[model samples]
Target: MQDLAFRFLVQLEPENASNFVSLSNLHASSGRWDSVAELRTRMKKKGIRKMPGCSWINVNDEVHSFYVADKSHKCTDIIYTVLDSLLLMMKGEIDVPGLGCMK
Candidate 1:
């Protein structure tokens, strides 16, 4: 599924930095840090500066914004830790129905 999405992205915008950024994000989410770093390098080579990373949350009819490198919240580390934990858990025995597979 992710491969298909990545293919589509590259097809739509072969050299777009935004597409590379999205790809890097996907790779990071999948614990593929090497790929992420590679994509980042590609972006740099293409003279593409990354768009500022921002996140938003709605609370009490107000929208709160956060940016990358903001120390107010440790969002990056927290998410990385969560993904690491999930990877560790996935390394152990896991039951899958119908496919007769275990991980």
Candidate 2:
């Protein structure tokens, strides 16, 4: 894998490159390399440039935002590691892999 960040499928706008990248990452994480290659091929044919991801938080009536591949935050790695750990724990409890709608 190309670093740990390549393991997640982040949300993206419809028909955007980030959407394809997200799907590709999802496939990679699930050991579906063929699907990842297919997604890349389609993206290449469509001339899509992978877009940066963005996330925001509302705290004390203030907004904090960040983008994928951004390195401005000092604690980004720690934050993500904690998140991954939490996700693993949740997955173990629920017997589910990957993010899916709860039912």
TM-score of each: 0.46, 0.38
Backbone clash total, candidate 1 = 0
- How much lDDT does each candidate structure score? 0.75, 0.70
> RMSD, model 1, all Cα superposed?
9.8
Clashes of 2: 0
* Root-mean-square deviation (CA) per prediction: 9.8, 12.0
40, model 1: CA deviation in Å? 0.7
- Poorest stretch of ten by lDDT in candidate 1: 94-103
Q: After superposition, how far is residue 23 of candidate 2 from its true place, in Å?
A: 12
User: What tens digits encode model 1's per-residue C-alpha lDDT throughout 1-103?
Assistant: 8757985996788777777877888899999999989877877777778667898988799786778866565466786677677676666544435535543
